[model samples]
Target chain A: MTAVAAPTRRRRQRRHISPVVWLFLLVPAAIEVGLVFWPALNSFYLSLTRWNGLGAPEQVGLDNFRELFSDGVFREALGNNVIWAVGFGGLSVAGGLALAVALNKPRRGVGVYRSAIYLPMVFSLAVTGLFWRVQYQPDGTVNTLLGAVGLESLERQWLADPKTALYAVLVAAVWRQVGYVMVLYLAGLKGTDPSLDDASAVDGASAWQRFWYVTWPQLRGVNTVVFAVTVIDSLRTFDIVWAMTQGGPYHSSELLSTYMFQQGFTFLNLGYASAVAVVIFALALLFIITYLVRTLKEEVS
Target chain B: MSAPAVTAPAPPAASPSTSHDRQRVRRRGWAFHAVMVPLTLLWVAPMAFVVLISIRGFDDIAARGTAALPDSFTFEGFRTAFGEGAMGEALWTSVQVTVPAVILSLLLASMAAFALSRYAIPGRRAILLVMLAGNLLPPQILLIPVSRITESLGIYDTLVGLVAIHVGFGLGFYTFVLHGFMRSIPSEVTEAARMDGAGAFAVYARIVMPLCRPSLAALGALATTWIFNDLIWAITVLRTQAKFPVTAALLNLQGGYVSNWNVVAAASIMAAIPTAIVFFAFQRHFVSGLLMGSAK
Candidate 1:
């Protein structure tokens, strides 16, 4: 800890800007600003215009925003995004926390179980999307298994039904996300001060009471991070939804990201898509700003 | 990946335990296994299905359906999938883009990370914030203008365009992780080198770079998986099927062979192999990197 403290003191006193610093920083800064920040800012400006990929830009201030509000598809997309954020984010985090708590202690074959649970996290969402899409077919594995288990009456067209399409996609998203959350929580659990657990155990506290009072409080940092990640991931979702449904069945599963893609590339409504992109950006920015402020404060302290 | 050693050593500081405590611990372990074993099986079942479908003949699948056990298994699907020639080209394209993107991004990010972590730069916190914010923004927001930029720069629909966007997009998260790792290094080592008249470049090259190998390796493994798995950028930037990465190509293959579930399954499984291999090989570092970045 003192090693880090000494560097801060030295950093404050050292005022000279080396030429090496410029050389090292220039290329990454150029790429980041040019490709990322510049384009992100340009998305805002593009939203206010009525330009396709070709032809001169025609300025149409706030028209796209107005159109977006009135657009039923966009509204559906927004509603689905909210549902996705809540459903996928909430379920995955809860599932992950549960898995983490279960696997926290050292036990035989725990590593194998951890690996099996995390295996889905490594696959591309494209593959997972396709895999689940097939499995959700009416005559697919899901229905077949249900029939074999004597639940034939409960089977439905999982992906084809508008009411269940977004939820079906959410199931796949959660499959991948839960593993990520579990890994993070497991690491957090390992780093926790076990003496606190032992002290509470000695105090005649029940197991659940010890965990809720002593353990969960220590995991506030992991919870914030997991929540932020879940929010951002839900907003950034595209590959799986696009690959599976293409936001179809009357745009029932249309997320903001997928909607942005449809408007810009598929429909050539670049301006309208940019507006959708802006909304996505705004939603992500809200959580990102909070996360950054908190993490940076931690860095400082 | 190396399996975590599973020695069940009791905590040294644990007080003398009664028989009741021993029974409780045993019960907890049993409960954990009872819950986790089935969940783990359920989680892996999807991919296992894909692998099974990929190996069976299309006729076998058509006759038996996807859920039933195959009457016979053959590599005919794999042969047809790979012999189509597009898979090979797409895999090459993926390699072409992912390799350069990972290398260039890591090079640039490590340099930036060293400067931010070691020096007394102006507005360092602001710069860090900017990088974090850039990473956190959804890529769809950049899709419109970035594609236009690539077009104007004459790199659109090319591997160069793909690599450039990947590097640019990857810079933030890589730098964030590398900076955190670099900051934890003891500064006295660098101070001594500086006192010995080593220039900043010399200090960075001879000192910081070597120290960053573990983090760099971790980021490299992760970045490769991400760039290879990317579909949105490939769909937005590349115009030709010939230049499509494996993920996009898999989507195309699925479209072209919609009725041929066996071929699509084979192609999808093939597309997934590289990342799976990378993940298993570097599982330890990858998990550590993720935990390091998120857990702070």
Candidate 2:
């Protein structure tokens, strides 16, 4: 420990950090800490107390969490979040990988196809939700199409029905997500070594075999990135859910995010909302910490 | 058009054109198109339907539901969306918040990146980790304190307050990306400048920033789309209708025009137009930026 400390101490003394470094770093650091970390820490404290936003918070040790565990709506929201993580993450990654592979090579009008697939990524979730809401209406696009296809029995009020509301919302969310994931995978594909592809082919490997053995392994870094993004996005999904159903139809579509918002803002149960937020933070930490450790290991080296 | 040369060299042949290889390539191309064409059409159908709905008259939509082909089209929806829906004012508000926020965030992030990458500052790893972790957390976790802080700062309900919040939150991801880019710049170049008596600030301003143009443009386009489309932050901080950004105003329009599909569609399109322009115009830089960030 002393041997390691001596060199770091000597190196630090040798390279004097200029005031300009401090000036440049501290300004942004100060604002970020004040705005983000400070608030986050305060929320952690607030979770352990009861507050109505108008008065000083009264201390309550873990009662909010205890109440959360027994709360039917909270349990529903938690269950829905897990479903979202699976459905959103699984479908987006699968669909995105297929799109990226198809668009990997230069071809006639590939750019057009790529752009057409990706254009949805730029739309705000509010727009996506509103647009899908119209389509999900009784006499809207979806039911109309179903009727035209002679599947009249399949037609339902997509967003209004408690059974279909969450899944319908998931379709819209996945529609937006696939394009972003496709872009990331396309970037990952560009870095794949072409020599390996030829070598595997020469060994009589089929396309599937070549891709699985040669290309898939090369995508470890990007897989880590995609996993991190998809999971976090699933956990924090609020805007589209908010605009479409607002966790409606008797909280059938409720997520931790929307529930937290309703509790904190609408009902003014600030402490309970903070507790929900803490749960979200803990769930997200599972993926965030894993990604960070890998990224930081690479960075520090 | 000249097809882009394949990156992998083709097998050695008697002639540059090999009919055997060409046949296989053609077959593969056909297979790709067979799969992609239908999928692309299906994927883009929702937005296309929205556009179609936006152009049709509300009476037409009512008579023949949204899935039907338009019997006639009009600009009536756009006009009403701009006028009664107040979408134009909301768009202007978004521009005000997004432009300044993106610029300030990039400026501050670039400076921080330069310092972190170039100088051996104390606890550099810790600082970067904090900033990175900050960006990953859900905004809802920080929602209450951010609201209270903005309220206390007396900037609540103002565009300036929204801009500050955007910059504060944006600093982390932007700084991380810029730091990766700056670190790749060879030390010899900065050393040469130092030998010529350039101070740290001068080396940064004259040397480092210009070298980061691609990343800046990419990040700028990205940040514009994100900040413009941001609904949660706008809703959390601003209360007045006039101060609301495009997303919030669009939501209001949706609530008001429940039966007016044309008008709501028009407003949604209007809200999407700016980001679409950015996406198309800067596609190359943004794609490269994604590549660059992942490479780090």
lDDT of each: 0.87, 0.88
Q: Which lDDT tens digits does candidate 2 get at residues A96-185?
A: 998898788776768878888888888888888987987898888889888989999999999889999999999999999898889899
Scored against the native two-chain complex, candidate 1 gets a DockQ of 0.61
Per-candidate RMSD, Å:
2.9, 3.2
The sequence of per-residue lDDT tens digits that candidate 1 reaches over residues A1-301 is: 4767777676553665588887788779888999999999999999999997778888999999999999999899999999999999999999999888877876687788888888888889998898897788776789998998999997999888898889999999889888899999998888789999999888989989988999999998888888998899899999999889999888988898998998899889899999999999888988998789778977898
Pairs of residues clashing in candidate 2:
none
lDDT of 1 by residue, B192-226 (tens): 89889888899889999999999898888888889
What shift in Å separates residue B82 of candidate 2 from its native position after superposition? 0.7
Model 1's TM-score against the true structure: 0.95
How good is the docking of model 1, by CAPRI class? medium
